[model samples]
Target: MNQLDIDKMVLRLNVGYNGFKFKESDLKDGELKDWAKKNNLLKSDDKQKD
Candidate 1:
């Protein structure tokens, strides 16, 4: 999937899951990318293992 598709999927799935209320227009590209990365919704480049 492309970035747009990934963004939409993540937003839809995460909303209301952990008290997060995200709308389509609520976040910008960078913000969404950061949020996704932080939440592990997207591939993380972190070298540290869990």
Candidate 2:
């Protein structure tokens, strides 16, 4: 998909999540896990797996 379409999907997802708003870079750079860890968004088991 195009960037605009990806942006729109990210926007929609962020709207549903209340506090977390993910940037395209987060997904693109594979930093989502780190971001989630910093934000305390990951579960204890998931964190351990990482």
Model 1 lDDT tens row, 1-50: 78877876767576536545444244666866666656655432454453
**What overall lDDT goes with each candidate model?**
0.57, 0.49
Q: What ranges in model 2 sit over 4 Å off?
A: 19-50
Q: Against the true structure, what is every candidate's RMSD?
A: 9.8, 7.6
TM per candidate comes to: 0.38, 0.34
Displacement of residue 26 (Cα, Å) in model 2 is 18
RMSD to native, candidate 1: 9.8
Identify the leading candidate in terms of TM-score: 1
Q: Give one digit per residue, the lDDT tens place, for model 2 in 1-50.
A: 88655655565566457745544334443354455446554344332442
Give the Cα error of residue 3 in candidate 2, in Å. Answer: 0.2
